[model samples]
Target: MVTVKMLKPYYIKTDNEHVRIVLAYQYFSIIIQEKVYQFIPIEANEIRINRRTQKVENIDAKFAFQHGKDVVYLTMAKLITLPDFLQQLHSIAGTYYIQDENELNGNSSIQHAVLIDELERMNILRLIDKALDERDEKSFYELVKLL
Candidate 1:
């Protein structure tokens, strides 16, 4: 189930060549980006966090092609509206050839998982309370602007 802090005004961006997923993690939010049909494993080090003040140091991210098959993109900056973004993603998916039509049609779902306890500036914030947090200031500044 979507949690209290995450059930607020937040944004996402996905595109033909990229996909951006942002969720609140404890005192900070984690933004994950993956290129279409890529295998970019999420590295623990890649997640940016602030330790002293315990805040997210960076939010702006670039999704590079992790794998060599399909393409995905960031959801918020490109789509502008969530509904519109989803619609576009659907249309784009329809354009691809289905190797296993049934498999492609398999049911899936999306849920926002909270990594932190509360929301900051309407977005999930306050990660300092959690264990082993990292902060990247430049990234946080970028995320603040996007959120």
Candidate 2:
């Protein structure tokens, strides 16, 4: 039976589509048969997650483990067998996922505010143009002040 001793990403990188969990030496460890094995990044150094679905996209990434002189390279497919390990990984990554969501929401709100401001400005410009067309000096002055 395999058991996870420790699992932590060195850092998380986020883009528009994906979140990457970068791993470093000694950052992840597991135990099998009472012997602790530290994970070493080999073919795979990072796990990619889909930002929208929050699901791991790279399960085939490889990692090496060492216990004394014996080293075994395994994939996420193997590590994911341990329910505890999977749960912990999700818990850690979920924090970053939530942060990404908050950031996107904040950005959307800012964009919405900008859009609203632009729309209001356009309306004012339209009113100013109407005032000029009608030769309404008082309305034109008031609209210009708004600008």
Off by over 4 Å in 2: 98-147
Winner by lDDT: 2
Candidate 2 clashes between residue pairs 3 or more apart in a chain or in different chains: none
Residue 20 in candidate 1, Cα distance off native in Å: 19
Model 1: lDDT of residue 62: 38
lDDT of 2 by residue, 1-147 (tens): 788888888998988778898988889888878999987766788888876677778888888888988887877788777799779878877765645568889999999999999999999999999999999999999999999
Q: What is the TM-score of each candidate against the true structure?
A: 0.20, 0.62
Q: Model 1, stretches more than 4 Å misplaced?
A: 1-45, 65-68, 75-147
Note the clash tally of each candidate: 34, 0
